[model samples]
Target: MGLSPKSKRRLQRILPFGVIWFVIGLFVLFIQEAATGNKNINPNVVITLTPKVFVFAMISVTIIGLLVGAVEILWLGKLFNNKTFYKKIFYKLSFYTFFLVLTIIIVYPFAASIELGLSPLNELVLNKLSNFLISLDFLSTLGSIAVSLFVSLFYSEISYNVGDSVLMNFFTGKYHKPIQEKRIFLFCDMKSSTTIAEQLGHIEYFKLLKAYYSDFTNAIINHSGAVYQYVGDEIIISWKFEEGIKNNNWINCFLAMKQDLHKKANWYKNNFGLEPTFKSGFHVGEVTTGEIGTLKKEIIFTGDVLNTTARIQGLCNSHNVDILISEELIKELKPDNSLEVKSKGIAELKGKEQKMELFTVSRSS
Candidate 1:
């Protein structure tokens, strides 16, 4: 059977990094062994990553790493996406604790066995085998855990700092030179945000904001949209023009986020004593992409499209709808049998030269 769309997309994300790092790990081990002049490093005479042993070690580690990747993508990623700040800290600690212990107890030994078994059966190897210095030490376990944590934490930090759009832009200094591209921008703002803030007060209001944004994260990621910014209780979501048009993911994401938030209504009521809602406005147009600031660098998108999108979102109250879309975006949206769209006529949006036709979109069912 052919791969499902979701599976194919997931693999597309995983394959390149997986192969790249596997090669890097192999070379690092080879160089480390070659450069070590101190013979007393391990004292325990054993098989090392000599050409033949490097192949076996690399294969073993790569397979184990892939298994970890599977768990990370399929379970850990989804599990952590919508969690509160404290919950995320707790979950990551627990996961790392479990993985560190497992790596020491199981993964290391298995890898060692693979190296020894695959090594040439020469006298030196046979002698090393008899001596079999497979002694487990506290230092070894601690060092391995330290290395594992470093790699994991570094990767996590980088991923958190760079949003999907930044990654899609190839993450180079190239954007600093200025480039123009068409993108679908969605301005999603919390309904009655000021009132909600006043009701909850400052401290609790911050927590409420965190929880609300966390809940919508999965919908955005799954729908291939990237967060552009968060202003007050508003979040700016964006997709490449083509990315949004394909299967109408940009529109579907808002609907899916609403569904997700609805499912959490009871939790919100119990925790915050109120249910929060959001209104979204979407449009498609060219945005100038460039890096902004010197000390605190960031990718900035500037254009009329963003301003127009924000104004459209402000119209949600007048139209009595949760989502509003500009004619430009609506024209490109692929027809989805599950969704229905109605023309909301032309409206002179704030700070614009011309009246823009609008549409209110929602699930047909």
Candidate 2:
């Protein structure tokens, strides 16, 4: 899913904070090192600093931490359909790798320095270098490695929980349980999406489409809507009755989604001067819902309502409208003076004998 403006702003804000805090933490270590009067400090000391090593060590750690933090922020912004399972493993692997390298960079040098410090000044450096190649304690080193792994895992768990909490708050507006019957289905599709893909080539087109899908999916989720599927250019979104009623004021959600699209449009325009647009349709009806399929089960909606929604969306091309909805959906909506919805009158839809009323939503009501 795409990142909300708020979430994006939050990430921008936190990135600087992470950098600042990391620097501050290193400075604190530098102060401690200075007080201890350790002149020849080892860069391999796991989490310590001395006067001679503080500046370089601090810069290294801060840069690495900021890089990792930036990666986390980017990953958080990308909305994966199954984030929970994937993210858990991703965090563990990332933290384990980062801390393992950091520990090696810090501890090995410190151990060598300690051994050398006990010797004469001229022999100190030579002795430490020779001893580093030999007489290293395998058992103690193994224990240190185990401790580092455990610490890294524990730290990752704590950080993940904190990050998840912040992410949930930033992205989710409100939550309501799904109501049994009456609900609305909205489908939005990128026009000539395939044509763009063909022109851009598979790899380039996939990246662009992925970004578009991510943004749209996040918008639906943020608005407490369930994303059903992405069929090529089209995305199907479902809103249950109760949650729809609760979030009847969807102007904010729409604005957020539009802003996201605007960003993508600008990027594409800059690179290829191609502006992408979407056509959307909505319908409200009673539908039975439950999980379908045995091994690869998925939440499925049954009945003609979904099919009708697709038909309504298809009408957009002939009607020359970007967004259209059934009269049934209009009636269910709590009227807003800001929207100018034009009644298109009863129209005969293909494949269905009965006529259905439709409307077109424009900038001006």
**What tens digits encode model 1's per-residue C-alpha lDDT throughout 1-365?**
76644575566445433454476565556555666752336534444545555666667556655655566556776678676655765676578667756554554444345555643444555454434435544354445444544454345435555753465454556796889999999999999989999999999999999999999977887787888899999999988888788778898889889999999999999999999999999999999999888787788899999999999999999999999999988888776788888999999998788999999987777
lDDT of 2 at 25: 48
For all predicted structures, in order, the TM-scores are 0.79, 0.55
Model 2 TM-score (2 dp): 0.55
Report the C-alpha lDDT of model 2 over 265-311, residue by residue, as the tens digit: 87777765587778888888898765445575344677788889888
Best by lDDT: 1
Model 1 whole-model lDDT (C-alpha atoms):
0.74
Error of 2 at 137 (Å): 21
RMSD per candidate (Å) reads 4.7, 11.4
Rate residue 133 of model 1 by lDDT.
Answer: 32
Clashes of each: 0, 10
